[model samples]
Target: MDIGEGARPGLRERKKRETRIALSWAAIRLTVERGFDNVRVEDIAAEAGVSPRTFNNYFASKGEAVAARQLERARAIADELRARPASEPLWEAITNATMARFALGQDDHRGAEDERWAEGLRLMVGEPALQGEFMKTSAAVEAEFAAVIAERTGTDADTDLYPRLVASAVGSAMRVAIQHWLRAEAPGTMADLLRDAFAQLANGLPTP
Candidate 1:
């Protein structure tokens, strides 16, 4: 039997991915329900139906587990950006890539999972204990974005300032947009906010 190049994961890999997803959601839910400091690794493990050791194998701390979804989304965004056609302008590619990963259109409807993730992210951001872990995850993902930027620009990530600068600016714009969305009473979809944010970047933030 010839396994195709794009074959699905084996049983072990599938089980591992399930466990990680379970733990990630469990951690987010527990941290939001019971304050971050109060949600222990064991609590997350129990919620996910896994052992504490399994939790440890997947994540270092409750904070890391809680931030897993954000990390996953960041990676997905990078992957989408990387796959965009080379002829597209960089900023347009970034904006479209973000929208694609989010599955967002002008009249997009959010599901329960999307609402839960938004609330969980808001709560995590407000928790001081999780800030460190969140920043670490953000930094790691920023590096990934920088690498992709370098690839597209044909520059060395370590030596080129342009890629790093663009990555930082874009990342900061997204973070600010998210924080603003979380604070708004009638915030629109994340996709819209992100599009507006990247639009500002593409326009060089000309005076309003």
Candidate 2:
């Protein structure tokens, strides 16, 4: 369901999106509860209150379905970054836009949603089979951010190296922050870590 430029999505498109989200959530929940290999496509479809055929239409494999939730979120971040004020400095805009996606300055309460995300991350990190799907989603988001950077800087993402280079650098910073946060026993909030990481980049990574 591709809406035209500057056009809002219609009811049909909205319903399709809702169904896809529901299916992705259902897949994640079932896999986390029963292990990825134990859960079948039919089980996921049933959990989502959809048919196997419908599930097939939305995702080719259980791994793809499970990864779709994060992919959707990554795309939303790209959209947020694209919507930032054109006058804002590129680094500031990207940092603010990315941070806006999460609840900043809030306590790390382990809600059901948080558990789902944590479980999915664990699965991605621990399971060798799911790593490829996870990396694919990351690569897609990297390309998305590159395109947004290209647009903001008036460069061609396909032809210009600058936009892609900056985007990749930002992505690496974000990945490292996330990994550090995950490994820390009493780590600071992800928001703070992300802010610090981006600040380092924005300031040219001054010497210690």
Candidate 3:
């Protein structure tokens, strides 16, 4: 076989991915059943039928297992935004990319998954340790967004305040929209709520 062909992941990669997914699902279920604080890493490992060492190999902590999908989604959004047309406005690019990456459309699992994600958000918000990890992951995405903004706006990422500020504001708006959706029991489509939130951002807010 060719060297490049031999380097392909094949069956092993697929099995590893399945194992990670199993561990993530097990962690989420455990967290839901017995609060985040009460669930230990070893418990999640047992629930997933894996050893604690295997769990650590996949994730740094319990919070990582629970929130890894969200972080992956954010990175996807950032990558999409970075690939958008250079002429697109920063906000427009970010909003469109985020929706494309995260907005749940007409899928059957939309309702149930949204509820679970909302519950996870609530848990993270209330837990100091999880909240810190959540913020750290979010900040990484914000930095990626800032880099995209800086590139499109012809500004240096280190020196420009506008890009950084815009990135922070966009992340804040998204969090607010998510909280609002959870409060309303995730009514209607998540895509609709996200679009409405982006529209509000497009329309300048009045000074308090």
Candidate 4:
């Protein structure tokens, strides 16, 4: 569907997004209730109220389905960063966009639900098959951010590697910040932790 430039998401695109979200949540719920290994692709499709073929159309594999939500969220962050004003620093823009998208909310599922999703993510980290898919998605996000940064800095994304490098570094730092917050039993709020993390990045890290 048309989603770029002046194009708006059409009815089909909106339906696809809803279906994808439903499938992703269903897969996570099933995996949380039963071990990831115990849940079959067909079972997840059924849980999501879609046929197995429809599930494949949305996600290539079960693991991908499980990770769909995070990947979609990351893509949204990239889009937001690309739309930020050119006068803003690349890092600041990206950090703001990322935090705005993922920052904790009062109604957000950060208790048992979050823990379950985190466990699923932890499992994917060790799964060899899913590693490639994860890397591809992460690289796509980096490229999107890099292109935006390149434009703002008046440099070509191809010749200048700084934008790409910075994007990767920032993405890694954000991932680490989230992991740390999660490990801390997700105490306080995601917004607070994210603000602290992004503030450090925006202010520049001090050398030892």
lDDT of each: 0.81, 0.79, 0.74, 0.72
Best candidate per TM-score, number? 1
Worst 10 residues of 2 by lDDT: 104-113
- List the candidates ranked by TM-score, beginning with the highest: 1, 2, 4, 3
Tens-place lDDT per residue, model 1, 1-208, is 3575345457668788778878988987787667687888999999999899999999988878987776777788899989999999999999988889778332223423366656765777888887888788888878888999899999988998989888888889878977887777677777888989999888999899
Regions of model 2 farther than 4 Å from truth: 1-9, 104-120
Clashing pairs in 2: none
Clashes of each: 0, 0, 0, 0
Worst 10-residue lDDT window for candidate 3 reads 103-112
**Candidate numbers sorted by lDDT from highest down:** 1, 2, 3, 4
> Which model, 1 or 3, shows the larger lDDT?
1
**Candidate number of the best lDDT:** 1
lDDT of 4 by residue, 1-208 (tens): 3356435557668899989988988887786667678889999999989999999898888878876766677677777777787777666787778776775323333643566666655554555765676677677767776777777787888888788877777667756666665566644666676667667766776653
Q: Model 2 residue 78 lDDT? A: 80
Q: In order, what is each prediction's RMSD in angstroms?
A: 3.6, 4.2, 3.8, 4.2
Worst 10 residues of 1 by lDDT: 104-113
> Per-residue CA lDDT of candidate 2, range 129-156, in tens?
7778878878877788899899999999
The local distance difference test score of model 3 is 0.74
- Per-residue lDDT value at 195 in model 4: 69
TM-score of every model? Answer: 0.85, 0.83, 0.76, 0.79
